[model samples]
Target: MIVFDLACQPAGHRFEGWFGSSEDFAAQKERGLVACPQCGSHDVEKAVMAPRVGRKGNQSGTRNATSPARTPVASEALPPEVAQAMQKLARMQGEALKNSRWVGDDFAEQSRAMHYGERERETIHGEATAEEAHALIDEGIEVAPLPFPVAPPDETN
Candidate 1:
């Protein structure tokens, strides 16, 4: 299923509607099957949405953006030394995360808390924007990114 951010034109209340595809959303809206959750307004349209795309082949199946599928780049495209080093680094990160907590999208907030002594410091791994990571580093908070992405726990089982 696909989810779209919807907004009521009259009331301007934003909400989400799930459908099987883009056509599904259009059909429902045309049929007045979609309505604003806040004011029960039927004059709803698509709202601004955040890009939700993540690493390719995410086990979570939470694709936020679609890209034209492309052929896989072969390992032969990289220097042998680089490929070896990357493989080694990926394994190391996977092992390290065995003891680290998955903080999801709250990495910046949680890491800052530890830096400011608002919370106890512990190993954590999570998704963080480049800006958020830089901010934490600027604040003298120690944060490092994983060499490889790990599937979210919720989607792993």
Candidate 2:
């Protein structure tokens, strides 16, 4: 997988996008499949990024006072309306998941079973690979990615 730093137009909300290749990113963008996770905008473009070079082993690990600081907080980086919308969306997702069953890695199988009437239909959520999701869709089974990543029930504190 390859990761690209992406920025949405107008809002300029920066995020990372992973694709199979650079051409894959281009194709997704052309097809309007590439969207900002924060604002759901399709007008996204690659953002400038510095090379990820490692420090020399002998170099000191201390930072100079003149060095740049970390990125701003989420609220500071986003417009008030956008931030509010995002918070609302997050709350909605949490509420939706409260009624959904965590099926873990059996997402694809459970989804297929339900689609073929082998299993009872109910609200379910879990993890699936991109290819698995595509295959499910190709077989006429409706599936959607969650707006936010969810930790497995077992992994929670």
Candidate 3:
């Protein structure tokens, strides 16, 4: 099995998919069978791959690196009202997170704690690995990923 990082053109949500071979990936893509799980977009393509060098202790120098593929959606293509709504949503989220604590990488844990009543519920936003977010969802915790990445607090200054 081969894993490919695929991105859907026209919202850039990156994801990984497996295929029988490179040809299989192409075939599926051509048929528009591949879709972005995040946005259900079919305009998918291989994401840019990064080069990696093997360490001295590693036996094989070759390594496969995959990155999350994002689906691109042209915001300009949307109706003005829809675009305005999206902008409003983004602005609302930004305003909400402004006074909220920036927990950095502790997003998942902190969210879980609040869900389980281990920590007091308060506005917060931070980073969470995709897997961690999935786990949180599975556990019935209410967590929503941010539409855009936020710089860590320490990195801002």
Candidate 4:
């Protein structure tokens, strides 16, 4: 799965859209399936985003140009409590999905089957385009996305 920075053409609201692949995003956009969450506009397109890269040399005293112009913040800007809580949440998620099936990009189909009673319900997780996820929600399907993305087993290489 991949995430793209998206913008609403009408309102110019910038947001993120997750997709199984670039083609999935294109197909959804072609069908006018993606809408801006802020303004409910379907005229959405990919927005320019800076790639996240690690610091070159050391983390001593350096700031990237992309960061908003402001006084330098120490690494401790994020409270230790908040950081620890986030780590705990990640561990909990990992444990929860230890036995879940990785259905890769067939998430929408598999979820719909279970939702319509065409297949028995079971624990499963996989990738789906933002539009697909929204569609499932609209159909009252009990599907949800993981807080953090997992690498597909087959693509781990």
State the C-alpha lDDT per candidate: 0.77, 0.85, 0.76, 0.80
Runs in model 2 with CA error above 4 Å? 1-5, 9-39, 42-48, 61-77
The collision pairs in model 2 are none
lDDT of 4 at 32: 56
TM-score of 3: 0.49
Best by TM-score: 2
TM-score of each: 0.48, 0.60, 0.49, 0.52
| lDDT string, candidate 1, 1-157, tens digits | 8888988999798777889999878765654567775565889988989866656673766533675656776422556676788789888887898899998889899998988889998999887766787888899988775545466799796
- Model 3, C-alpha of 116: deviation from truth (Å): 2.5
lDDT of 2 by residue, 1-157 (tens): 7889999997999998899999989866764578887777889999999765668999889877898978876533777887898799899999999999999889999999999999899999987777888899999999998765677999899
Model 3, 68-150: lDDT tens digits are 55678643365677668768988987798788999877988999889989989998888766678789899998877565446
Q: Tell me how many residue pairs clash in candidate 4.
A: 0
Q: What does each candidate score in C-alpha RMSD?
A: 17.4, 5.5, 11.8, 9.6
TM-score of predicted structure 2: 0.60
Order by lDDT, highest first:
2, 4, 1, 3
User: Which ranges in model 1 have alpha carbons more than 4 Å from their true place?
Assistant: 1-80
Query: Once superposed on the true structure, which residue ranges of model 4 sit more than 4 Å away at CA?
Result: 1-77
**Which ranges of candidate 3 are over 4 A from the true structure?**
1-44, 47-83
